[model samples]
Target: MIVDPAARRADGESVRIAKDVLCAGATVRLCLPDGPEEWAKALAKRGERRPVVVGDDRALLRVVSLLHRERDLAGSVLSMVPVGGAVSLARSLGVPTGAVAAARAVLDGAERRMDLLVDDSDGVVLGGLTIPPLRDGRGAARPASPPAHPWLSTCRSLVRGFTARPARAAAPDDAAPTRLRVEADGVTLADLDHPVAGVSVGPAARTGYARVEVHPALTAPGTAPPPSPLHADARTVTVTGADFRYRADAVVTGPVRRRTWAVRAGAWGLALPPRP
Candidate 1:
């Protein structure tokens, strides 16, 4: 299945590569941009089968969300060809960068079942939460806000640097740090009030991956904070009483507290290229 937003397909090459793969005997299906809900409905009626996404990280997240919702993740396979902007998450997963290489991976690579995160509100199978400094009046503070045009998003991030706010007393850095109590497998790892530069959780993290991190406000920085509480096989993580926001894959999903997420092990298979 190729769940693509029409905006992404505006590029001529992507469409041509997709058609080339299909013509070469790949069983391809297009999931248009009506909404994920409609795609889910179509998927449900299609019955059990492996799924391959042909868009960026967000598209991959959408398929995972659907599988988790149906509780069919353990038996299904998922793959991707990463054909849009914001493909960093997929790159982290070792998926090839070029369209042809990615397509070949989908067609010939070995299948592997990976862990997925299931939250009460939404489920994501890739990178989650990296809180950068909130953008000023430009509206980059919230994740749910639709991403500005790619150039605009970049320009806005740059402009935020000049208009940065003063630090606050509690954070001592005027950064809007959230007070969060994070627990995993019934053990408390982080319990404090401090400015948080960013937080990321996912299997894609390697020796350098940080399960959790807190830093002084960006405006008050001396040195970057070190990675903290790395989880090699983190199955369950909970975040509570934090006013901070989080980005999952490429979308900003929440500002809610009391969020609990668990990883479903060996949940879905993904396509990859054959070894040379």
Candidate 2:
């Protein structure tokens, strides 16, 4: 089991529960790596043992990334027990939210293939990516706040009030939306002249394509909303415009002028609890 330091810091109870459950099921080797480099080494030495990540989305991504770089991703089956400050990615992939349940799943689950998005820079996206709605000339509006934890909702709210990024002041004039050229499978989704409010790309229901959506900024009261957020499913999604930032799963990245992510069908595998 590979335990992330951030997971320990964010929710030790969940981490403990996962460990206890996993240990009870089978012989286990606990890997407590302090940082990414150590984490890579731990995974490298995993040998035949199935690598089970005991942390949040970022932790899981790290393992996937390292394995991909080693050319071992397609053949490796991974298990995960989500325990962290952010678990949306894990939850979205159908992993149980409860520590005991997740750990139990890890022990008895079946391996299932999942699709992935590999970008130009070789980074992967297991969940999804989004370009937040532009707010005037100022930087993009902070991505929507993560949903509060159900049981610890109140605590999260209190914590966020103290930690939230200060809101940017409104610009002196009505700033134009960011002008971006978005394409899916080489088909134009959004033209550059008209600024767009947001764009999202994710694994689609179909096996080998990504669902892309481009939402144009709301126009004046009378004008039609720029052709209802363009939507499509494609094997590749590309965005080109001025330097912009985007959120991929839990991490925010990019100021790049262009990025293209291609769908890699069944590029990765996950060990998930059997249905029914």
Candidate 3:
């Protein structure tokens, strides 16, 4: 098992629980790295033994990113025992949220294929990606936060309050709504002429496709209402606009003028709990 240092720092007890369960349930090699370099080195040398990441979504993404860089992602079967405050992506991917349950799933689960979105710069998104990347809905209105371990949730809140990036203040001359042109497959869903509140792209319900959605900017009082929001399932999604930011797999990135993402169906394998 490759244990992330951040996971150990955030919730050592949960890490201990996952480790104990994994050790007792199967023949495993524990890799307790002192830092990021060592942690990556451990994974690099993790030959033959199933690589079970004991950490949050970030660590899982790190693992996937590293493996993808090495061109070893497709042939490897991966498992994760969610152990930190930010394991929402792991939970969404069907890994058990509890330490014991997740570790147990790692031991007894079967591998399942999952879709991936690969971007122009070779970045990967295992979960949804948002244009503005707002976590709290950017207003008084917002969605409830995902559930997480009580203590881990507290820990994450404390850490985030200190380390999270400050929200970007809007600049003068900037458009009230983001102005971008979005395309799915070859059809245009949005364009620079029409401002958009936001855009998001990710795996769709249908296999071998991605769901691309463009949210229209709220109607101005005197202007005709913007076209209704557009959405479609496509093999590829492209966006071109002024510098913009995006959040993928819970990490914020980019101020790029253009970005394109293509769906790679069944690109990797993840372990899920055994069927009932």
User: Best lDDT goes to which candidate?
Assistant: 2
Q: Per-residue alpha-carbon lDDT of model 2 for 1-276, expressed as tens digits?
A: 999999899999899989999899998999999988999899889999999999889899999999998889998999999987688889989899899999998998998899999999999999899987554645555676665667577787789899999876676644556888999999998988777888999989999999999988755656775677788999999999888889998688978899999999999999888978
Ranking by TM-score: 2, 3, 1
Query: In candidate 2, what residue range of length 10 has the lowest lDDT sum?
Result: 133-142
Q: What is the TM-score of each candidate against the true structure?
A: 0.69, 0.84, 0.82
Candidate 2 residue runs with Cα over 4 Å from true position: 138-168, 171-176, 219-222
| Cα lDDT, all candidates | 0.63, 0.88, 0.85
Lowest-sum lDDT 10-residue window in model 1: 206-215
Candidate 1 stretches with Cα past 4 Å from truth are 27-33, 45-49, 131-174, 193-197, 204-233
lDDT of 3 by residue, 1-276 (tens): 988888888999999998899889789888987766786798789878889999889889988988888788999999999887898898889999999999988988999998889999999999889886223333344567865678987888899999999877655434458788899997998888877888888779998899888989864757877677788999989888888888898898978989899999999999898768
Task: Report, for all candidates in order, the number of backbone clashes.
Answer: 5, 0, 0
TM-score winner among the candidates? 2
lDDT of 1 by residue, 28-128 (tens): 66656568678787567556545667777777777777777787766776778778777898887778878778777777778866656667776564555
